[model samples]
Target: MVEGKGEAYLLIDVGHVLTHAAYIARVEGTARLAAVAEVTTTTAAEGGLLDGVRRATANLELLVGRQILDRAGEVRQPRDGDGHGVDGVVVTASLAPLLRVALVGLTCDFSLASAVRAATLPYVSLERTVSLEGPGDAWDAEDLEALVQEPPEVLVIVGGADGGPVAPIREMGETLSTAYSLLAASQRPAVVFAGNERACRPLEATFAGVVEVSAVANVRPSPEKENLGGLQGELAHLFYKRLGRSEGLRQLGTWAGSALRHDLDALARTLRFVACRHGLARGVLGVDAGGNGCRVLWVRPRGPALNWAAPFGLGSGLGALRQRRDPTAVVRWMCHPISWAEAWDRLSNIEVRPGGVPETEEDWDLQQAALREALGATWQGAVRAWAGYAEGQAVGEADMIVARGTSFTHARTPGQAALMLLDALQPTGLVRLALDWANLLPGLSGLAERDAQAAVQVYDNDALLELGTLVAPRGVLRPGSRALRVRLTVAGEERAELDVPAGSIRRLPLGVNERGRLELYPARGLDVGLGRRGRGGVVEVRGGALGIIIDARGRPLGLPKDEEARRAALEAWQREIEQA
Candidate 1:
């Protein structure tokens, strides 16, 4: 960037596992951050983090900017190389040799799977996956033998994070330590631990010099929470550092540029952006709730945000919610005539307590109670506890509330806030929007990251929602029926329209990083993507235990239930992949 008359900036973010300091350069129209050297922090004080980072920069010192976290976002613009002592907190990048990797995970759901996705993302050559159904103690000498059968380039570890990735930390540590001791010193596989942040330090000390070691943040911070932006970026950086030796990145790194985004934070920001930018009112609420915690952000016209990341998630806090009493009492949209027994069973199934499922109605009742307890107890409680922490200036009443998390994500794709709205059931005006699909404003935001033109390419009115006029009054009331048509024209040529219904969902054919405007259909069973019932794009429905009204709008929807149908749907989506 020094060549582009630009600047190099470094960002340090401290999460559960790793503290990453990215060396980024921005000059003229170029930006790139070395993908390699993403290191995991084991020690709380990180005695060597800053030194290591500064040393790595020597190979390429044109870097002009430095960024680091002070736990609460301290460290503002410090002088280069001189920052080591300025703040007692600094981190450097660590490089491990080669590229062999073992994906150790707790569950195959979000966190573990997200980790695997991140590893495979850079298209890194993977070695194996290590899984433990129970505690790491369950894995004996034979297990260790299997993990070390061949000297892996890196050992990427992950497991249950809801309760903290600790139990297996000690067990996995002992096992990996044994493996490390047995391996030849020079050929020892470097350990790149990216699981429970709590395990990094102990594991590092346990296998000191036993093997090459580094750590990253938890792949999936919480069950429903995914910090893939950090994981994938760091993984790529590490991959480039070790495997590419700078050769792999070349033009790619230059193209990728130096600026980066924290995946969770970016996603939250994107959703908030969607709430404000896409809508006409200039105010939107987007929240992501998971097993461990929830992230809530409110965006209104002309200002900062009312945003925060809560360390409490629905699943992790279910037990706590029960203690608070009545999860449904406050949530009114759930008036689907669900019995206490039914609600209990639903919660029980979701909790997936190590070894149990509801068998009897009483068990079901217990489960519902647990679910209520869990939902009410957690980060949602944090919402009440930390009310308006995310509120910003120029904010009146919340225009629309967008939320996604395990509790919300698992319940309904786009149903959360709607459900809340329904429960709140104001007898007057109501605001409508597309708050479905894992709350993926970040997916669009990612478009901005991956390609600015593409980001602008997808940013049309329909691609975004311009808040319609509504004066909401407090009182529960379900509307009868209404329809509206929205046409989103981009660059005065390409256009996407939503024949959206006031009370129904219509799925659209999504092309890579593309956005569409939603307009209501004049008739039912009409195709939106294909335009005018051309047998191409029509709203499809797959009802879940969550909501019934079926209101959503997005392209390339998430996973399916039926095996054959899901397979066929996936095959069909290949078209979108090709189209994208």
Candidate 2:
């Protein structure tokens, strides 16, 4: 695809918990992934971040049974006759520090809300959200000192719709200029103006030489629409520019031929590419959880959208985990009752050893509980982002769901991963569940833009493991009520008829790579993405290690208030899937 023969491409993905290197070679003019290796990512190592990269690369070389780097410690390009080198290298990272951002806008409810949404991407963190409507003292010496003391890397100024609120916009601009003047030149933050258009020139003049300034179209152009594309793009560019200043990242970028990209962007690109390629108009949903953060990407027919939350995971984010709303939220997912203190203590260990894996049944239960809570929070954040951008736009419309992270990838079985997602997201429709367990999507992300066909072929063929197709209908019913009737045909085998009861989870065996035809009929008042209750439809689905899971757990999936009852329900669900 890159106009070469026997070309070898190396892809490296750096994350807070792990660094992975994958070697892909164009063998006989066909690109194929050769080997993959991973190493713990420790920033304190002598070589800093590059330490893990080098280790992972070395391990990958061992797997490929060749030398990819020279003695001088550089990736050797142009493979020799014996296949000792790669043609090019690309790097992607999720381990970059969050860009601290100060958002200045007209009001907290309107423009500020939009600014918050723009600033909450995986790589950008909102340090301050300042409203221009407040008193003049809001920008006083004390306030300015607080902002300038430890300057944020970027300042995002967004206010009223185009052709609206000129004076407020000017005042905010003047305030920003004053704040910019207080910061040391070396520490001054870049400023982005996405406010009223008429005020751009004056604002540009006000801070022209004092600080770096870029102006884009108003985020709220006319009250009816918000144009965040230009601002989002600018923010991404600035984030990368700041990230490149790091010592290790700079060197990695150089070796990558400036092909370094953000992990969230890569995830978004991969999902969008897959959905569009497959013509899946209902869109695809992807969620990635890691030691430092969590990311959710939704790809629709129009394009890809994202939501990010940081310091809120099962591992190194324990500090932020303490700030969550309720401690008991996760307990309901566990099979046995555990005190909040005990649960917190178990999770605290993950902060110390982010890559630790469960070895015992108790450990597994605790780990799954934490994962369930983290995913629920991540989903809620994504929903909020969608609400901020467009009313009534929810993630439920997604017909396919893909997940990544240690919890999903390292689960004992595909059924474990599927149940975790089902319990956390609780969608009321038929959906396909898959896991990026192989960590191939990030590599594909780097390759998609270069050799799209190769990247896609690899993704569909190897990247994802189809967990199973899930059918979850909405609406609650009596415990003994018949929720659905399913007729399934798989692998030349046909199931006469199966009835799934309300508040239960049922699994049917279907081998991997097997095709299946399903006819689903929901009882009265139940709906599985169909128009109404008593509706039915026939769909084609592919099988995986775990077959089709029919969950009549009801929408907003309920849990018994009685602790034992809740534990029993959870145990039953886990048993139902795990037995498969």
Residue pairs clashing, model 2: none
Error of model 1, residue 419, in angstroms: 2.5
Where is the poorest 10-residue window by lDDT in model 1? 85-94
lDDT value, candidate 1, whole model: 0.42
Tens-place lDDT digits, model 1, residues 1-580: 1211223333333222233333433334454433223233333254443333333333223333233333332333332464421111112111222245677665666556677666643124456765665663366455567777776666777765735847667676777787678767876766667777877777788787687567777777776777656566666666655433433223212222332333444544555565556563546655544444444555555443444443333444344343445544322212233555465455545444422334664443333333333333333443553343334422323556554433333332232333333322221222433343322244345445434443343343113322122212221112223333444333344344544433333333333333333223333332332333322322322122221122321112223354455445433432222221
**lDDT for each candidate structure:** 0.42, 0.77
**Highest-scoring model, lDDT:** 2
Tell me the TM-score of model 1: 0.33
Backbone clash total, candidate 1: 61
Per-residue error (Å), model 2, residue 398: 1.3
**Once superposed on the true structure, which residue ranges of model 1 sit more than 4 Å away at CA?**
1-260, 275-282, 308-314, 325-349, 353-396, 406-417, 424-430, 436-439, 459-471, 475-580
CA-only RMSD, every prediction: 21.1, 3.8
User: 1-580 in candidate 2: lDDT tens per residue?
Assistant: 2333336778888888888888887666667777878788868655687778888888988899889888876787767789898766768888777678888777777777776766656567667766756675255466566677867888888887877757767666776777678767878888899877887877787786788679987877766777777788889988888777887778777864646777777777777777887677777888887877666777765633555554677777765766775867667788967888887777778778888878888889988887888778878776765654543555435878999988888888887888889887887687878998768786787776666666766776678888888888989988769999998886567854689999988877776787788889899879987777778998887777778888898988889889899898888888888764
TM-score of each: 0.33, 0.87
Best by TM-score: 2
